[model samples]
Target: MSWIRFGRCLVAALLLLGAAGVGSAAVAPLTPDKKVERGGELTASREEFHLVVAKLLKDQGFLDKNNTFKKGTKMHRLFESYLQETLSDPAVMDFLYTSLKENAEHVTDFDAFGKALAGEYAVRGLTRLSESDFQELLRVMNVLADRLPVRDCAGMLRPGSAFDYHWLELLPLDDARVYLRLTKQALVAEITRSPRIAANTKEQTSVAYQALYAEIRRRLAPEKLERFGKIWGKPEAAGDEELCWGYRVLLSGILDLPVEPRRWMLREYANLLRPPQ
Candidate 1:
C-alpha cells in the first residue's frame, strides 16, 4: 500500500535511469495480476533461508561489530555539534533551498526528496516485468530486500529501511518478522564493521537529518533540547550512525549527495568510531 503510494522507489540514489544521473529507468507500472499458486508452488523453506542467511553472515561478515556506543557517549557530542554547524553552513542551506524550489517547479511529490534532484519523469515499461505482472514484478526486488548489509560502490550505506520493510511485509507475518530482524541486524552490523559503510552512512545521515534539522533548530530550544535529552539523550543521546542511517539506503532521492558534506561526515564518523588519539 505504502509502496503503491510512494511508487516503489528502488534504491533511488543509485537507481538513476542513466549514467548521466537522469530519470529512473522505465519500469512497467506493476498491476496486480491474480497470480495462480499451483499445487507444487514453493519458495525457499526456512532451513534453506537460514542457510542463505548464514552464508550472507559468513561471506559478508556483516555481523562483525566494529564499533559500539551507548547513550551520552562522545558520539552524541560529536553529532550534536557537527549537525548544528553543518546545517548552519551557508552553502548547504543554499542547496537545500534551491533544490526544493526547483523541484517545486517540476513535480508534486514534495515529501520524497532524495533522488528527485535527478529528474522526475520515470519510464516503467523498460523493466523486464510485463504489464499486469505485479506478483513477479515487485518480488524481483526480494533480491535487494534480502541483502541486509549496506555495501557501497565502495561498500554499503542505507539511511532508511521503510521501503525495504514494505517489501518484507509481503512475506507471511511470522516470516517477515524473522527476516526483517535478520536483515536489520546485518544492516546495522555492516555499518559499524565497514569503514566504507560508516562513511557512506555518515554522508547520508546529514541530508536526511537536514530535512528535519530546520524544525529541530526552530522548535527545539534549550528547555526543549533538555527535556528531550533527559528522555533520550540522557547525559547524552543514543549515538548510532545506523540510527539515522537506520537502514535509509538513506532516501531523499534528491540528486546524488553533494561532495563536501560527505567528506565532513566521513571524517566525523571516523573520529566518533576511533579512539581519541
Candidate 2:
C-alpha cells in the first residue's frame, strides 16, 4: 500500500483498538510521568500537549477557518476525537511515549515530544520513500523556492559567461565591479583548491589557475576588468575590508552551487585547463 494510505489505515485500526479499550489495563499516558506545581495550574507538558494537538489539527485542515480549540469550537471537537480515537490507543500512545522518552531527555513538554516524533517518523519514513515521494518533495521544494524573496540563481551563471551584472545593479557601479571581480577570483580559487588540481606541481597549479581565470576574465566587461585591475593590482587589495566582505558572500554562493552539473562542469574545466605532461 502507499505510505499515506497505510498511515490512514493504521490510524483507523488504532481508533478501533482505542474504542474497544484494547490493552486499557496497561495503557499509559503520552506525557512525561513527572508533574510540576505552579499556581495549581496544569503542567507544562499537559498545556503543550493541547497546543500540539491543536496545531496538528490545523495543519491537517481538520479545523474550520474560523475555528480554534476553544471550549465549544469544531477544532476542539477534532482534538478531542484525536485524543479518544488515536492518542488513547495503548499501542499508539506507548510507542510514541517510549520513542521520545528513550531518545530524548528534555522532552518533558508536548512540543518537544511532538518534534521528537516528527524526527523519528522522518527517519523511518525514508526507508519507505518511493520515487513518487521524491518527485513530490522536489515539487514542494520548487514551489517554496519560487515563493522566496531572493531568487534562486542556481546554474544561471556559466563558466564562460559574464556574471549577470543586472543582479548587482543596486550597488554603486564601482562596488558592482568589485563584486564581479571578487566573485570570479573566488571561483578560480575554488577551482584551483580542488584536490585534483591542488595536488599537482606548483607550475601546473599556476597554469591551471591562470588558464581558468583568463577564460573567466575574457567573458567579463572591459570596464569591470579595468576596475578589478585598478583595485586588486595592489597586494593590499587582498586585505581590503570591503572587497573581503564581498568575496565572502560571493564565494559562499559559489561554494553552495548545486552539486550536480556545476560540480561536474568544474571538474571538466579543471581537466581541460591542466598543463599536459
Candidate 3:
C-alpha cells in the first residue's frame, strides 16, 4: 500500500480502538478558566502556557504510561502520521490559524503564544487525538517555536529583518503552512535516502524503497529534490550507519526530538534491517 494509504488505515484503526476504550483510561476533559479570552491576543506567561498544555495533555490521558499506545510509538511515526495529518488537514489548520490569529495580539513570547493557542483549541473540542497524537502535537509546537521566526511573538521574514509592525499583527498562517510543507518534504526525502531503510541485498526491499522514494520525490519541486539528492550523495552520507545517523540528525533538527531518543530510534530501525548474526 502507498504510505499515505497505510497512514490513513493506521489512524482509522487507532481512532476506532480509542473510541472503544481499548486500553484507554476514562479520563475527563479539562475545564479551562472560562474567563480566559477565547478570541484575543495571547498574553499568557510562558509558565502559564506550559501549565495549560500539560494539563490538557494530562486530561486527555496522554501522560498515562501504562497505556498500550506508547508501545512502538517513535517520534518519527508520530510526526509522519499525526503531525503530518494535522498540518495537512485544511479544517484543522484553519482552526489552528483562526485560533492563533484571534490570540495573536499582545503576544511577546511566541513559544508560549503558540502553546496557549493550541491549548485553547484543545479545550474547545480539538481534543479527539490519541495519546500518541497528543504527544506529536506537543512536539510539533516545540519545533515551530524553535525554527519559525518569532521575534517578540511576531513572525518575521528572517532574524533581524525588519518589517512594518502593523503587518506583524496578523497571524502568518499561510507562511506557517508553507514552512510545514517544506519541512515535511525535506524529512520525507531524507528518510528515503537513508541506507538503513532497506536491505541492500534484498531486491524486494530495493524495489520498495525506490518506489517510495519516487513517490515522495514526485511530490517535491524538481529543484528542491535535486538539491536534496546532491546532499544525499555526499561522501559523509554514504554508509548504513552514517546514512541512518544522517537521517536521525535531519529528523532531530526538524522535529526537535532530543538526541538520546532519536539515537535510540535510529538504532532500533537499523536493527530491524540488520542481518542475523
Per-residue lDDT value at 40 in model 2: 28
The TM-scores of all predictions, comma-separated, are 0.19, 0.25, 0.21
Which tens-of-lDDT digit does each residue in 208-271 have in candidate 1? 3353333333555767544433322221132333222322222221112244443333233222
Better of 1 and 2 by lDDT: 2
Alpha carbon deviation, residue 122, candidate 3 (Å): 2.3
For candidate 2, write residues 58-145 as lDDT tens digits.
Answer: 4434333222245553234443443344443334444454445454544446544453353333222221223233223223323322
By lDDT, the candidates rank as 3, 2, 1
Best by lDDT: 3
Query: By how many angstroms RMSD does model 3 differ from the true structure?
Result: 19.6
Model 2, runs deviating above 4 Å: 1-94, 100-107, 151-277
Q: How accurate is candidate 2 locally (lDDT)?
A: 0.33
TM-score of 3: 0.21
Which candidate comes out best when scored by TM-score?
A: 2
RMSD of each: 24.2, 22.0, 19.6
Off by over 4 Å in 1: 1-73, 105-111, 114-277
